[model samples]
Target: MITTPEHDERMAKMTFASVYPHYLTKVEKKGRSKEELHQVIEWLTGFDDKKLQDLINEKATFETFFQQARLHPNANLITGVICGYRIEDIETPLTRQVRYLDKLVDELAKGRKMEKIIRGQ
Candidate 1:
């Protein structure tokens, strides 16, 4: 499916905080812990507990959230189909980053080991 620029725009404008709870519920319902979820996010975005909370409290948009992120060096290693799009094939940087995060969380929820999710530390 071609992602129209408007679609990307809406996705970019999505609030990270608004979507966080859903992600948390998905993982937790699958027997994962919040720490594990946070670990996955931190690995992708480099935001520790406080920073993450601050962003959440501020209801940061995906654009603002990523703008503040110092992405992991191995973030490119995160590649797969997620949300119906191939992660590596995504042309928009923000969209790719979002899918990288989604793919990581999906892996965690599926019980993949943390070492593998973070690309072996």
Candidate 2:
């Protein structure tokens, strides 16, 4: 088990851009389109393609990435277990946000329809 400060420190140093390609690869390998991935991200963060690209180019850390993000009102609708931690049970704000993205991607890779993943069915 990790402590909050430890998790926060790690997230603060982790760059979203460095791992974003892996997310793209994961979904693409599952036959999901990159457009779909972008759509979900936009829905969650309120950052359209251009803004997202700008953030990626800036090499934003997970904290910085979410700090600038206007999280969707329905984001609370996204709930489930990811990597052994229940999304709602996550104690750290930044870590919860990261896991939210992870859970969404996991849903996509599982072949769930976009509507359900985005709207939380």
For each candidate, C-alpha RMSD in Å? 1.1, 1.8
Cα lDDT tens digits, model 1, 1-121, are 4678997999899999998998999999999999999999998899999999999999999999999999999999998799889888988899888889999989999999989999977
lDDT of 2 by residue, 75-111 (tens): 8888988888788877787888888898888889889
Query: Candidate 2: which stretches are off by over 4 Å?
Result: 1-3
Q: What lDDT score belongs to each candidate, Candidate 1 first?
A: 0.93, 0.87
Worst 10 contiguous positions by lDDT, candidate 1: 1-10
Clashing pairs in 1: none
Considering only N, C-alpha and C atoms within 3 Å, which residue pairs clash in candidate 2? Answer: none
Model 1 deviation from native, Cα RMSD in Å: 1.1
For all predicted structures, in order, the TM-scores are: 0.96, 0.92
Q: What lDDT is obtained when candidate 1 is compared to the true structure?
A: 0.93
> In angstroms, how far off is 6's CA in candidate 2?
0.9
